[model samples]
Target chain A: MLTVNNLHASVDGKAILRGINLKVNPGEIHAIMGPNGSGKSTLANVLAGRDNYEVTSGEVVFQDQNLLEMEPEIRAREGVFLAFQYPVEIPGVSNLYLLKAAINSVKKHRGEEELDAMTFLKLIKEKAALVEMKQEFLYRSVNEGFSGGEKKRNEILQMALLEPHLSILDETDSGLDIDALKIVAHGVNTLRNESRSMLVVTHYQRLLDYIVPDYVHVLAHGKIIRSGDKSLALELEAKGYGWIEDHASAA
Target chain B: MAGLKIMQVQPDTMLASGTQFYLDQFEQISDKLPGQNVDWLQSSRNNNLARFGKNGFPTQKDEDWRYTPLKPVTGKAFNLKSAPTSGVEHEDTRSQSALRPIPGLNCHRLVFVDGFPEMSMSDIAGLDGKVSVRSLSEVLAEDPETIRDLLDSVVGESSHGFAALNGALHQDGLVVMLEEGAILSMPLEVVYASNQELTLVQPRNLICLGKGAKAQIIERTVSLSDSSCLHNSVTEVILNEGSELDYYLIQDQSRSSYQVCGVWARQKESSRFSCHTVTFGGGLVRNDLRSEMTGPGAHCDMLGVYSLSAKQHVDNHTTMIHGAAHCTSNELYKGVLDQRSRSVFHGRIKVEKDAQKTDARQSNNTLLLSRDAEIDTKPQLEIYADDVKCSHGATIGQLDETSMFYLRSRGIDPDVARSMLTYAFVNDVLGQIKIEPLRDYLEKALGEQLIREKKLFGQTK
Candidate 1:
């Protein structure tokens, strides 16, 4: 469902992602774990199409099309969603209005009839319940004055509404309490389907316990050095990223 | 006589001098004005002409005209085209051109061309037996009871030199009145056209709300002149006791045109007055808004917003005097300056000693998009009473970097993200605009200023 080949990216004069390759099929979840300065978040941002990072040499294919050729809004329309570590706070734009616009943008891309105000209200009510978000949160400006936990949960709620074919979670678990974690995890679980795919990027394995990735790859210096099953997360937890680095160098 | 009158009508101020030709060519039309109408009005114009003959034009030495000097305008005069400007029927705005009616506006509608009314550009279905619509000349011919006595009474007749000159030379404007306790269902919208070639129009409007009456008046002053023209306009409003009035001023003259606009509002006991000024065009624009709350429970809301680019200049000065106890006034003026453009905001709220329990608030917020662009903002509050609640605040800054970074991080290109954040900042003020269509157009226009650059922004993905 997602393929990134020879992804060499940089910012300013320094290189970040160097000669990277990754692929994930349907019903599969991939967790990219790395220590600080490991380009873990950079890979997520690159996939999300942030322009600040220059992709020097790479080709990203999503669903057999040139993903890099599409605009960010078009990528969203094509069922590509990114859950940010820090969501943007749009002061004058209401959360509900922004969500509705996002949904409508994707829907219009799919040639679907736009939802009316009444239908939108009903849809939001059900989704808000999934994330434990009150209706008042929707009425206020997007991400404005929201608590840290609320911001993370709101990101998940957007992911759920978008129902993207390939969703990237960039540290969505950071700053979240255990209950918020569970609620967000529950939302992810509910959204899991046979055709959907996810790339979960994190610095720790705690988030993996909830979403439970099918595969774990240890990324170091912008390249994945090791790959394994769920046990790799636990093993790394028991030890640390330093063991992986030392072991890779010794080999 | 034509050449001499043109020279005599030359503007004596910098703001006026830029378009002094409009006054110069408009010399012939002066005869059409000062009709043999009301004796009081005729004598008043004579008094104004004599007063103007003595003063000539105010200089920097004058107290009120200190910030603005007029020597440049008086140096030379251009011919003011006598014929009404033609071929300016449509505006060249990028957005959709549709006129929508505003419900709940209470008054009769009168449209104007240059300074005179052209019967072709008006919608008069809203006026029936309760109200009447006529040209300024027609008003002189058939004087109504209320309209005759109050024509130039509140305007700067003897005191204000330009106003006196306009009274002596004023051509046409709108006259509206409502019966006591009458509630108007539709607002009266007055459209003034500055379309004639090389035309200069000095327009004036007089509106009176009878006792216990409610009315709304909107002046949409637009000039499509690509050449240099001038539009100097003034309006005076009088609200009787227990009356309510809402006035809206939408100015979109040509970028080469210059305008000096002023409005004076006086409220009686329990009368409510609100004026919303939306200025988006003109080469140089200066507006003076003054209101007096003379009765308890009388309320006033003064709101303004100006968006300009290129060499456009917008200057606004507002004064709200609290004369009676338990009265309230609130003011908010926001501006966006781009390119080498400039904007000035000076607001003053005065609370008298006897005006206790007076609640007043004033705020001025401006955003400078370019380093070369400049805005001067000053919010003034004078409290003679210790028991009044008065507050004033002003802020000038660029867009928030954090918000811009956050948006860009969301996969939005940096430029697109910056534009979004800029829209959000101005929308914080636009959100208060009560009217939907005007708000919608202004919103699109303001946002267009950001992304409508000559070059393309960075492409995403």
Candidate 2:
């Protein structure tokens, strides 16, 4: 579903992701675990076409199209979704209004008919329920004065509504309590399907216990040094990131 | 006058030429003016003409008009008009124009054409007998004493040049007086339309609300002519103790016209006054809003929204004075400038020494859609009382790039996203309007303006 060849990205003349390569097939869930400053979030942002992250020398292909050549909005219309670690707070723009505009925009790109207000409202109610979001939050301004957990849930609600082909979850488990982690995992698990692919990036193994991944990769110094199954996450959690750092240095 | 060599001529001589021109026009139409036979009004006009001749028109040198130049309007000659004896017989083209009647607002409509009040086009039959609504000409011809008293006291001329000119030339307007404890169920609409070239008209309106009375008045100025015209309007409001009044000043003049308006209000003890000023179209427009809280517990709220594009110029000046103790005032004014348009905002709040426990807040914000578009805003607070709370701020900026990106990332077109954010920038100020239909109309008008401006500039995709 997605391929990254020698991904080399930087910000402000400082290299962050150096010589990274990864591949994900259809229906596969890949987890990338790393310590702080390991370029986990940078990789997610670079894939989403954030302009600030300059791709020095690399190419990303998704759905038979060069994702790097497309604009952020075009990438979104082509079914690439990034659940931001910190959702933007946009005042005076209601959550429902943003969702409707986004849905209609995608529909227009796909040559599909736009949904009317009544039809859109029904869809929003159902999707909002999947993430356990209250109806009042949908009417409020998008993430303005919202709690951390509520913002995370709202992101999942958007993911469910968009139904993207490839979803990148960047630190969605961070700043979330146990209950919030469970809710977020439940929403992700419900959306799992045979044709969908997800790249889950996290610093902890707790999220893997809920939405168990097919493959686990340990990223160190901007390179994937270890690959294993779900048991690898538990072994690393019991030990520590220092053990991986020592092994990666020896290799 | 031009025979006098341009550079060799003294500045005072040059200024006198402009003022003398209006004084000569007044002399030709003095007999046709309202309250001509009244001794006090005649004297008032004479005194105001003399004052205007001395002050002439304000220049960029004046601190209040430093950011707004007057050469565009004052450099040209105008043909002053007197009251039209009979109502205009032209087809009512308002149905096709942008000035549509606000739906669901039961209003008493008054129409004026070329500066003359048209009784045939007005609808005063719905007004209760208790509320007195009369054309300024009728009142001046029959009961001149009432207006004479107001002009001598509350609605007197100010030192502003255009206001003095209006005082010398104003012949027809609306006179609405309410008795004590009276409440108007319907709003009063005053519509002014100009249909002449190089013509100048000054319309004066007087509103007097007795104690405990409540009323709402909307004044809209528009032009149907394709040629250049000028509208110098003045509105005077007097709110007695416990009275409430909501006044709306809407200016949508033709692009070839120049408009200047002045609103002066006085509030008694415990009275409340609110004014909403909306400016949409004009070649060069200026509005002056001045209010004084003379009684304890008086409250005033002033809000404004303006959108300008192309070569349009709009200036807004507001002043609130707390003369008594326990008074409060709030003000918010926002504008969007596109193309080569320019806007100026000056808001001042003064709390006197005797006015304790006064709370005043003022904010002015501007969004520039083009690099060439300019905004000069100043919010001033002068508090002399120790127990007063006064705060003022002004911000001038472009659209937020982060917010723009957020909207674009949702697969929305960049142009549509830009227009939506522009509308949202000024939506809060419009949300304060209590009249639902008026608010809806303004929102639609502003939204269309954003779209039109985006198309004109061919914004980035």
Candidate 3:
């Protein structure tokens, strides 16, 4: 469903991603494990077309279309989702209002009829239940004064509502408690389908325990040094990234 | 006559041509002004006319008037005639449409055409005994002594050119007087519609609320003609002990119109006063709002919101005075400017030496949508008392980049995102309005304005 070939990106003349590459087919989950400053989040942001993350020389294809050439909103309308590590706090735009506008925008781009108020309410209620979010939260400002766990859950709620084809989870488990981590993992597990793909970027192995991935790639020094199955994550957790770094350097 | 003689003696080159024109026109209309036989009223007019002539409209050299220039107002020799011009006769259909009542608001409405109260268009049937609502000209003709003590008391010995001009040239306005313990259930809606081009309309409103009285007023100024006009208005309010008043001024005029408005209020012990000024359409607009808290336990709130586009310019100046102990005041003003429009906000808070335990807070925030749009904000606080809490802050910026990206990343179009954030910036002040219908109307109007501004300046960004 997605392919990245020799993706070299920089920010403000500072190289962050250097000659990186990855591929994911339909219905497959890829877990990207890395140490600090390994360009994991940078890769996710670059894939999402965030400004300031300039793609120096690279090619990203999503469903046979060039993804890097599109605007951020166009990428989003084309079914590319990035769950931010830090959700923005918007004081006046309500969560429900944003959800409606987002859904309608994507639907309009896809030549589908917009959902009425009743249908939208019902659909949003079901999605909110899937993420275990309260009804009152949808009426409040987006992520303003929200707790860490609530913000993460709100992101997942949006993901469930948008139903994007390729979802890039950027450090989604950093600030969440164990209980919230379980709920987020459960929501992701429930949304897993034959046509959906996900790139789970995480630092610890705890999140991988709940939402197991089919492949685990170790990203060190802006490149994926090792590729293996779920067992690589367990090994990295047992023996920290130091062992992998030494082995890759010696190789 | 003495003031006219003094003005005539001054060299023609020494006085601005606009001020010279008004001075010449005042001589022809002074004898026909209302309250001609009343000594105090006539003396007050003469003194203010002299003051206006001496100042000749404030220049940018003045500290308070640094950001605002009166060239547009002073360049034209606007008509000073008290009577409505022939174009706006009683049967004029456009005047009626301009004076239409606010939808969903049930109240006693008084309409004014060219500064004169239109009795045929007003509806104040059930407000006779409970509340005294009369035309200022009628009151001045019948009994000038009734409002002598209240008129011009709030703006005492001021040197503001517009205020002085309004004091001297005001022909007709509204006078609302409430007795002790009286509660006005319905809001008083006053609509001032300008239908004459190149005409100067000065309206003076006097509101006196006795002890424990409560009232709400909605003052709206609109323009019916596309031609350039000038509207100079002054409203003075006196709130007795334990009284409460809510005043909302909505200025939506023609694109070629110039407006200068001032609202001065005085609050007694345990009284509460709140003023909401919402400005939308005008070529050059200036609003001066001042309130003095003279008694203990009194509270005041000054809230405002303005939206401007094109070459529109709006300036809002507010002053809060804490003259007694245990008083509190809060001020918040916000503006949205797009497409080379400009705005200014100057907030001044003063805590007198004897006014201990005073709590005052002020904030001004603005959003500029285009590259050329500009805003100048200044917060001045003079606290003489050591045992008081006063805080002031101001911010001028564009729509937040992170917030924009957040909205756009969720699939909202960039234009829609910009409009949403712009509306949200002003929603803080709109949410404080207690009247539902008025708030709803403003929200709808502001929404339409945002759409219009987007279409006009969407490509500039």
Candidate 4:
């Protein structure tokens, strides 16, 4: 579903992602774990085509199309979603309004009929319920004065509505408490399907407990040095990243 | 033309050519002006005309007029002429289109063509007997003493040259007077349409509400002529004790038109006054809003929103005076400038020494959509009372980058994203409008403006 070969990226003339390569097939869930400053979020942003992150030399192909050449909105319309670590607080644009516009844009790009107001409302309600979001939150400004849990849930609600082909969850559990973690994890687990692919980026292994992944890769110094099954996350949780750093240096 | 009187121009006063031209026009029309036979009215006009001749148009040197330049208005020559005795017999489609009534707004409608009240087009019947609505000319001809003190009472000895010009040369306007305890269930809609080339239209409106009375007034100024014209209007309001008034002014003129408007209101004890000013058009425009709280427990709110594009320029100056104890005032003005358009907002709040327990808050915010677009915002607060609570703030910025990106990242087109954020920036003030139909109309108009501006600039970022 996605391919990243020798992805070399930088920000402000400083190298962040150096010689990184990864591949994910259909229906596969890959968890990228790394310590602080290991370029986990940077990789997610690069895939989403954030303007600040400059791709020095690399190639990113999504569904056999070059993703790096597309604009951010084009990438989004092409079924690429990035759940930001910090959801922006937009004071005037209502959550429901943004969701509707987003869905229609993607649908229009796919040559599908736009959803009517009634149908859009029904779909948004169902998605909000999946993330345990109240109906009132959808009418309010997007993430303005929202609690940490509500913002994370809003992101998931958007994800469920968009139903993107490649969903990159970047530190989705950073500010969420245990209960919120369960809710978000449950929403993701419910959305799992045979044709969907997800790249879960996290510094802690607690999020994986709820939404287990098919593969776990340890990213160190801008490169994935280790790949294993679910057991690898458990090992990293038990033994700190120090052991992995030492092992990578020895190897 | 048979009754024309040529008065001598004063040579002692040094005036700019623009000022001399207006002074000469006023001399020619003074004899035919309404209430010319009344001693007090004539004397007030003479005094204000003298003041205007001395100062000419306000220069940038004046403290209150620092951010606005008057060259565009002064450099052009506008003839001062009286309105035709009767309404236009032929229906001019341009002026007719400008006078189209707002849908779903049921109210007392009054239309003015080139500063003259159009009785044929007005609908003020079925009004409560206690409430009197008539044209200023009619009142002046019948009994000028009735409105002698109310006219120019709120704006006494005004410093603004435009206000003085309006005081001296105002041809015709609307006068609404309500008796004690009388309430107006429907809003009063006043539409002023300017449709003559190089003509000067000055309208003076007086609204007096007695004790315990309540009323809502909406004033709209529109331009129907393709040629450039000058529209100078002044509205004075007097609210008695416990009376409440809501006044809205919407200025949407032609791109080549020049407009200057001033609204001065005085509130008695326990009275409430609110004014909303929305400006969308005009080549050069200036709006001065002043409210004085004269009695205790009185409250005043001033809210304004302006959207300027192209080379259009707009200046909004507001003053809130807390003269009595226990009075509160709030002011909020926002603007969106795109392309080379410019906007200025100056808000001042004053709490007198005897006015204790006064609460006043003022804020001005502007959003610049292009590098060439500029805004000058200033919020001033003068609290003479030690126990008063007063705050003022101003902010000028571009479209927030993060907000723009967030919207675009969700598949919204960049143009749509920019427009959405721009609308959001001014939506707060728009939401405060209580009239649903008016607010809806403004929203649609402003939405179209945003889209049109986007197309004109084509991706400013």
Best-fitting candidate, scored by DockQ? 4
Cα lDDT of model 1 by residue, B1-461, tens digit: 65552322323423444224334433455555635556666676667666666666566686555555344333334233344556535555421132223333443456666676766557667454555545556677776444666776666543455565566666677767677887666767787766654455777777777899877667877764454456766687889999988788888777866777878888888998988888888877878898888888899999887877787888788989999999998898887777778888888889988999999999988877777788877777888988989888988888665565444333344565556666676675567665565567677766675667413322322
lDDT of each: 0.75, 0.85, 0.89, 0.89
In model 4, the runs with Cα more than 4 Å from the true position are: B1-16, B36-39, B85-97, B119-121, B456-461
Task: Mark the 10 consecutive residues where model 4 chain B has the least summed lDDT.
Answer: B7-16
Each candidate: RMSD to true structure? 6.0, 4.7, 5.4, 5.1
Clashing pairs in 1: B12-B70, B13-B70, B17-B73, B25-B79, B25-B80, B85-B196, B105-B186, B105-B187
Candidate 2: which pairs clash? none
Give candidate 1 regions above 4 Å deviation. A1-27, A34-39, A49-80, A100-139, A193-195, A218-227, A238-251, B1-28, B50-108, B123-136, B144-149, B153-164, B224-227, B400-423, B435-461
Candidate 4, residues A1-251: lDDT per residue as tens digits? Answer: 99999999999989999988899998899999999999999999999888789999989999999999998899999998999999999998888889999999999999999999999999999999999999999999999999999999999999999999899999999999999999999999888999999999999999999989999999988889899999999999999899999999999
lDDT of 1 by residue, A19-60 (tens): 788999998999999998889888987887766778899899
Error of 4 at A192 (Å): 1.7
State the lDDT of candidate 4 residue by residue for B153-252, as single tens digits.
8998855899998888887888999999999889999998877777788989999999999999999999876667899998999999999998999999
Docking class of 1: acceptable
Better of 1 and 2 by lDDT: 2
TM-score of chain B of each: 0.84, 0.93, 0.93, 0.93
- Model 3 stretches with alpha carbons more than 4 Å out: B1-16, B36-39, B86-100, B119-121, B455-461
Tell me what TM-score chain A of model 1 achieves. Answer: 0.98
Task: Show pairs that collide, candidate 3.
Answer: none
